[model samples]
Target: MLRIGSGAGFSGDRLEPAVELAEKGKLDYLVLECLAERTIALAQKRKKSDAAMGYDPLLEKRIRSLLPVLKQNNVRLITNMGAANPLGGAKKIIEIADELGLHVKVAAVTGDDVLPYILKKCDSLEFKPRLSENVSILSANAYMGASTIVPAIETGADVIITGRVADPSLFLAPMIHHFGWSTSDYELMGKGTVIGHLLECGGQLTGGFFADPGKKDVGGLAHLGFPLAEVQPDGSALLTKLPGTGGALTLRTVKEQLLYEVMDPSSYITPDVIADFTTVSLREDGNDRIVVTGGSGKERPSELKVSIGYDAGFLGEGEITYAGENAVGRAELAGAVIQERLQDCYEELTVDYIGITSAHRGSFSYEGIPYEVRLRVAGKTYEREKAKRIGEEVEALYTNGPAGGGGARKYLNEVIGIVSAMVPMDIVEAELQVMEVKPNGA
Candidate 1:
């Protein structure tokens, strides 16, 4: 049996929960999945500015906090913290380990960035025509799977860093290496994939995102613990979190995570296998523990999903609050004022009344007016100055329009748009390199 714990779900996740898992979860491997579609795109922009700055911003902090305990417990670490540069991330980890006087082996799996290859083979590649036209490609990464990661694990690396791979593959790789599961073993691989999916989101399955107040009550969310999976050699798993922790691991929580981000539950495609979530079954084995089984799989997909990012435009946003006596009416008037002012400056504009029609977009009845309402104006433009003007016009509404309007806020940000395309698996290659760190003064 292997005990693998999820240390992080996204890039900005809290570190204390991971520390708790490493210290108390008795984990064989602690995997942190920090990269998201937008996160990697931003990382590519950062790497373009500085050669050594593409990985997760908190990579060093996470390592510095958890390295000692992980080393002491002999639990290996696996992560895709190497957002755009795996080698750079590996060097940073080695440097941190050296400073801590800890001898550690770090392995980095690379070759996921396939931008150059895609550009060269654009005419021959099997993807949409739109993928090649009308946009500057900032980053193009193919989602690698456990096959490339298994070699690093086999080398007994203390820490494994990867650039861009499927999130579940981070957890699945260790299971494959530990159990020697054959790639063609679709049923077992499917089971392992199910375990990976459940544990991949860190606290989502452990009740972090499952709270609904009066409906689905979860306690101690402030100190909510991450999740762990006790996976057997047969690929079946028992999902649970640390005892006395802040979150619950009930069947409802598990089911919610099971369907998260799943477009087609019958065919959840990945680089490794096509897992069928519809065939899966769950049963409560004990308190805060559910037995997972019946995850079957077919052959792996022929093409890998590629995340392509490009600069879309710039977004400008501004908000103002109106309170007391006809607040809704005043807020509506303020929104109209800003829209009228910036009609020609922006390509698109939106006027939302925060309290009345922001969420439903006027779908619900507006019979009862609220005591306070916030007026938000947002616009997008190719020109940065034009985008900034949207917020400037909204901020000017304080002196020129509406009574009792206060708490003005404005911001402008670059928009990085992401699109998904398919690349043949045979064209993209994955490689692993290992680096060993000695004591600091050695």
Candidate 2:
């Protein structure tokens, strides 16, 4: 059996859980599934500024913290924390490993950037909003597959980093590398894909996202542990977490995670295969352990999905807290004042009294008057100056608009929106570049 642990679920996840996995989990591979749909687009923007700054900002810290333990425990790491710059990330890893005098092999799998391919066929794309001349494209990346990382594994790399690979591919790659699972083996492919889907969100499987006050109570949330999967050659997995770690790994959390972000339960599509999640079966094996099986897959898709990032505009936001006597009224009145003054500044405005009605936008109200309320105003505009006004107007509330209003803050940010297009599998190529430290020393 092969043991794989998830270190992080998203780009900004906490670091300690990953370190815990490395030092204590006793695993074959630990994957930091940090990249998200919008994450790489932002990384691309950062890359345009500093070539070496595009990868995960925490890449250095993570690699530094994990190197000694991972090397000592002989646990390999596979992660998409490379974001927009896998080669840069790999180089950074080598530098860190050398500083610690640890000998290890690192490989970067690249070629997910498909900007040129998209630009060549933009006019002919079947998707809507077809490459408008006015739209400024920031980044275009094709989601890579598990097969891409297999070559890196074959090179005996201790750490493998990649950019724009699918989340499941990070976990699935190690499986493919260890089990010798052929890409054409649909049954095993489907089974392994489900394992990735379940464990990709590190803490969710361990009850971080499943906690409720009393309804679905999870114990010891303060030190919630990440999850790991034990896989057999038959493609079945036993999912669990470390002992004495806070958080429950139960069937409830597993079911919720299984259905998370899955629109079509039977037809979950990925670069490597089209897995049928509906075919999956889950059974409780013991406390904090579940046996998963029955996931099946069809052949791969003809076209790989591409995430297209384009400059949307600037988003400006401001917030102020209102307390005591008719706080909701004061908050509403303050929002009205900003609304009347800035009608023509932005295309649209979102005004919310956060504690009272942010969720439904005042469509429904919670019970009883709250003692305190917060007024928030946000809008997006094509002009940065206009966007800046959103924060300015809210800051003005401190002196001009409402009584008892305090703790005002404002922010202005660049906004990048993501759209989807399709690229054929043949057009995108995945290659591995290896950087190694010798067995004797760096």
TM-score of every prediction relative to native: 0.97, 0.97
Candidate 2, superposed: residue stretches over 4 Å from native: 128-132, 439-442
What digit string (tens of lDDT, one per residue) describes model 2 on residues 1-442?
9999999999888888888988888899999998988889999989999998789988988888889999999999999988899999999999888878889799999999998888787778765445557778888999999999899988888999999988888888888889999998988888899999999999999999888887999998999999999999989999999998899998899999999999998888999899999988899999999999899999989889899888988999999999899998999999999999998767799998988888886787757898999999999987999899999999998889979899999999999888898888999999889998654422
Please report how far candidate 2 places residue 428 from its true position, in Å: 0.3
lDDT of each: 0.89, 0.90
Checking candidate 1 for backbone clashes, the offending pairs are none
**Predicted candidate 1 versus true structure: per-residue lDDT over 1-442, tens digit per residue:** 9999999999999998888889988899999999998888899999999999999999999999999999988889999999999999999999999889999999999999998986776666555436546667788899999898999898999999998999888989999998989988988778888889888899999998899999999988877888999999988889989987898899999999999999998888889999999889999999889999889899998989888788888998998999999898889888888877777766679888898888999898757768888998888877899888877887888899988889999999999887777988887888889999888566
Candidate 2 matches the true fold with a TM-score of 0.97
C-alpha-based local distance difference test score of model 2: 0.90
Which regions in candidate 1 have their CA more than 4 angstroms from the true location? 123-132, 365-367, 440-442
